[model samples]
Structures are given as structure tokens and as C-alpha cells.
Target: MKQVHLAAILCLGFIPYSLTACHAQNKTSQELNKSPEAANSTSETVTTPSSTQIQQAYKVNNIAEFNEPWAITPLKDGRLLVTERKGRLYLFDPETKKKTEIKGTPKVAYGGQGGLGDVALHPDFANTPWIYLSYAEQGQGGYGAVVIRGKLDLKQSTPQLTQIEKIWTQVPKFSSGQGHYGHRIVFGPDGKLWISSGERQQFDPAQDMKSNAGKIIRLNDDGSIPADNPFMNQGEIAQQVWSLGHRNPLGMAFDPKGQLWVIEMGPKGGDELNKIIKAKNYGYPLVSNGDHYDGKPIPDHSTRPEFEAPVLDWTPVISPSDLNFYTGKMFPQWQNKAIATGLSSKAIIIIDTMQQPAKEVQRLDMKARIRGAVQAQDGGIWVIEDGPQARLLKFTAL
Candidate 1:
């Protein structure tokens, strides 16, 4: 074990925020408040400042390393089930520093943005041992995100998944593009399975409720449509649409207040953090705080009043991936706050959730492309870096 020291304080009103009702007291980045057009209405120009020195506020231990590790689901028995982008699952024991490959996993397409993704245990896992997995499954047209549930047996000599059943798959159609598989599957407080299905870089589909692409789908644990789903009886569109108009959502988690938050990748700039609401349209291709990769300007969110604007928009895109709410005792100051990792930023952003819409307060540079982050059973923050040699890194207060 190593001891690391980070200089942290419970600073209030840290930086100026763009989210409505948030007031930024100081300029944290070069472009903040630089846009004359962005100063009006529900949106404001907020940018992250350069990385600051932490010297090491926490010690880091490489618990386990895997090839392109995607998500970390901490097991109750001091073990972890980690998914690799190559369609494999492993039982990792941090105490033993050993990793054992699970016997079965769905055969993923194993390419750009396709493969194994998020994994989560059923809330009643102690009794049922049901495990849910999201991945890029081969569909008829093209690859689309799919979710499945199975019984996980780790006590046996050979840990494996059995009695597996298909729970849900993206609706309407699949896509030819390999990237933008918005496949974060999480169970909220209501026991409903909420899923994020990306647009696969397809623009118009996000705005079309008839197409399931670029929408969040909610379902019962058994993959059946809930009786009270927002779109339950509105024809084909009633099949599964929970919230519409998203581009490439990668992270989703519930805050202590029971609010579900999502972080998504945008085009050239304008990565977003949004508070999700049932039946709300998020305005993807129609409006964006960012422009197209070709340098073409897309209308900003202020142009549309009906769509739910992002609580925060990253002008210099962060490529955010995983989200974890801090509830551990290790970071008392961060209890119930939102912590997120990003690929392009190579940092973990700490946001203050005490506001109407969450506000970014601090950016801790992790010095790597962080893929997944979760709070461990022991109150430690566990994160996996992105790469063939991706490592499960643990962060604990000194």
C-alpha cells in the first residue's frame, strides 16, 4: 500500500457555472464567458480550467489489469466482475491480486465500439444471483447494443454464467457505424432497468421517436415493458422510449437525491451532462452547444425551449465515459457528489450536486484515459484506464 496526499478543501462557489441558477464567481477556463451569444437564457459558456497539482491526494494501487477493461461491478465477497471490450468477463480479487476468467460471455463483435460493456448485479442479488450485462450484439442489420441477464455462480470451481436469457435489445433498427454504442444499463431506485441507446453517429434518428436510436429505454427486470412507461400506449413509439434525443451517452447513475444523471459525447465540442426526465426530448442533431466535426455550426440548445438543455456543456469536449456517485466515508466532503471520468480530459471531474443542476467544482487529472469508475465495498474509488493494458486502479484517502 502507498500513501498519497491531495490538497482538498470544501470550497464553496468554486468556479462560475453555466447551468441555470448557478453563478460563476471566477473564470476557470480560457473560453468561459467569452461568447457574447451564449450569455442569455438557460445556457451559459462554462469551460474547465487547466489541471492543478494534487501531488497525490490519494494512493493508487494497481489491483488488476485487463485488455480494454470496460466496467467494474464490485462483488459482495471482496471480488469484482470486470468486463473487457473483447467480450470477456473475469472474476477479480483485489486481496489475492488474482484474476480468473469466467467461462461464458456473449460473443461480441469485438471491434470499434462493439464488444462487452457495462455489468451490474441485481439489487436482490443476494437471493437471486442475477447479473445483467450490456454489449454490442450482432443483429440482422448491423451491430446494436443489447442487454441480457443470467445467473452468476462464483462459488463453484469454475465460475460462470448459466441460465442466461435475453432481456432487451435496441429497437427500430441497428446501425452500420462501429462507434457510439450508448450502452449503459443501470437499475434505478424503482427497480426499472434504464438503458441508453446511442444514435451510432446517425443524426436524424435521435429526434424521431419512431426510432429507438438516441433514446433511453426503460423496462422491467425481465425485459418486459412496464405498465407506466412514458410511451407505453402510443403505438410503435410506445414500445420502449423513455427519453428521446441523445447522441452518444456513455455514463448514467442516480444521485443521492434519486435524480438520474447522464453524460454523453458530443461532436467537435459540447460534451454534455444532463438530468434525465421521463418523455423529455434532449435535442441532439436539431440543437447542440457544439458544431459538427466538419466545423459546421449546429444550432445551440437555446434555439429550442422544449428540449431539456444540458446542465453543463464542455466546450472543449472531454469525451466522458463512466459515472459514480460518491457515498463512501473515505471522501466525507464528496458524499453524494458526482464523480466522472473522461477519455479526452484524462481526468476525474468532481461536481457539486447541491445546486439545481449539478456544477463542476474540481478536475483531478488521472493522467490516463479513464474508462470506468465505481466505489468499492471498502469505501475506495476504483477506476479502470483505457488500453489493451488497462489497469484497475484504486484510490483511497491517505
Candidate 2:
């Protein structure tokens, strides 16, 4: 794999709130007003350009680099833990600018969107030293995303995983090579593990409670379903489902006030940022702001107000990948803002939540396919790129 120097890429400063710039240049009012079928037909013919030529903010800098870095999390000692799509985890020291490959990760099925995905620290990591990982496990005829928890041993010259246990798995895996395995793992404030499973590109499975393919699943720290779960009493519905009707949700995080938030990719042009509530069904195939890739119409969320609506929706989707709520001292002005990594837009979107009905405050384009972002203990923001030549980048206020 090719490796690029971190300093080669530029780092754009945050756009002040006063700027009213919009990122959806290709989408027009006519397209937005068109019927779903008509809109879908037009979008099918409109090809999207790759990141190499996409326009972005001209001022961002890349601080560090990595190989196909997919997820990034901070350790207690101020070092960063990054995961590669090929199944290797690494320790990146910012001060020393060094990288150490970790050992003992489970073998992964790493090809065509399946691989070792998100890595996160346990909520009580300081006391337990436990870390959670989500990856695509190859078995039988295909692959499925699985979640595992293990202890990280840094005592050795190179850190390694120990006591790795499979906590959850997607049952009845499909053969589709490009299914959206939305495999992000987060620890809710209630000490429950919340995971977003994609619909596996199957429209019908999302509405099927019997299948775990497309649901937000909740489990206890030990991978057991909580007795008080919304569907615990239901005979057939999986006891682990917290909510349903999600398509390729890549980002999930909890705000300071304990509100659980998620962002998922829509079919044609509807990207959504939703605040997840207990037992609430966010309409998916039944209703979407975007249309199908084959130019088919899906109902709009406005038609079904009973289902939870996204707090914010993007018409020409930015392909949001990672989500983080900023509450650090390095940028006090950005406190309580939602920082999202953008793949299609090649930027970091800052949504200011301090105000009622949070809005996209700024879109600071980094000119790279940003995959994951996390706030460091000292308040600096860290981001990872999503490519074979991905890099670990840090952002500081100018």
C-alpha cells in the first residue's frame, strides 16, 4: 500500500458561523421540488465525481498519516488507537510521530467494503482496559459484521489484544458483495452497547423484526439483551432491537445531555442525522427523502410524521461517515457542536447544537475522504482518512 506524508495535505481553518455558504451546488431548486420519481430519474443520469477533483476549502492541513485508517479513538495516555481496514490496529503517538502495529486481532474478511471497521474504548476503559471492535467475519459462504470486546495490553513493546470475545454477530448473512454493513459501536450513557446494523441492501429485511440485518441493536456490556428492552416482551421480535428502519448508518454518538444521535446514508440524495429515541421507528424504505438508485420513488419523511424525522437532512447527500460531539477546551467556541466526517464532500461538517433546532454551522472541507473523528483529552480534534493511503490528521484552532 502507498503511504503519503501527513504534512502534504492542507488543513483548512473552521468557517466562522457568519458564512452562509452551501455545499450542494449540483442540486437545484427544480430538482428538490420535483416528484420523487422524476428526481430519481435525473439523479441516475448525473454522475458523481471522485474526490481527486471535488472542490473543497483550500486551507486545511493533514497532521499525521496511516494506511487505510478506518476508525480512531484516544487512549488515556494521550496516544491514539487507529484501526486499518485490513484488520490491524495500531498505536499512533502524536508527540513522537511514530506508529506501532497491534497484534491479536481476529482474522477479517477484508475486501469490497468488508473488513475490520470501527474501534472504540469501553466507557469505563480507564478502570477496565477493555476495548470494543466491529469487523466483518468471513464464514460459510459470505461475511457479516461482528462485534468483539477485548483487553488492550500495552505492557509489551507492541500492544496486543487479549481475552477477545465475540459479543454480537449478524445472523443469516447475505451474499451481496456490496451490502452496507453499518457497523459502528457506541456505549450509551445507560451503560448499554448500541450498535447500528445496515439493511444489507435488502429493502424488505429492514421492516422485518425477525431479522437483525437492519436495526439499532442494544445489549448489555456482556452482550446480553437487557430485560427492560423495548421488545423484550415481544415473542418474535429480536429482544436486542432498540429501533428499526436504518440504511447504512456509519456514525453514532451521545451528546452531553445524553441524547443518542446517528447519521446514515440515503439511497439517492437523502442523508440524515437523527436523534435516536427508545422504540421509535425512523422510516426507511417506507419513506425516504432520497429515491432508489434505479430511479424509483420512496415516500418522504414529511408524509409520515409518526415516525421519527431526522433533525437535519441533506438533499444532495454528503455521505457522512463518522460523528462526534465536541466538548473540549481547545476550542471552547465549538463546545456542544456535532462534528461529522464527510466522505463525498471531503470535509468536516460542524453542526452547532447550542441553538434550538441545530443547524449546519460550517463545512470545512479538508479535501480528503474523512472517515473517523474523535476529540482528544486535551481538546484537539483528530480525524482519519478513508483510503488505502489514508492518514491520521489533527486539527487545532488558529
Q: Best candidate per lDDT, number?
A: 1
* Worst lDDT 10-window in candidate 1: 30-39
lDDT (10s digit) by residue, model 2, range 56-105: 22212355666677788888789988888888898888888888988899
What lDDT would candidate 2 get against the real structure?
Answer: 0.74
In candidate 1, what are the lDDT values of residues 315-336, reduced to their tens digit?
6566788887988897675678
Residue pairs in steric clash, candidate 2? Answer: 10-60, 10-61, 11-59, 11-60, 11-61, 12-59, 12-60
lDDT of 2 at 293: 76
**Candidate 2 ranges beyond 4 A from true positions:** 1-61, 235-237
Position 201, candidate 2: lDDT? 79
Give the top-scoring candidate (TM-score). Answer: 1
Q: Relative to the unseen true structure, what is the C-alpha lDDT of residue 396 in candidate 2, on a scale of 0 to 100?
A: 60
The parts of candidate 1 lying over 4 Å away from their true place are 1-56
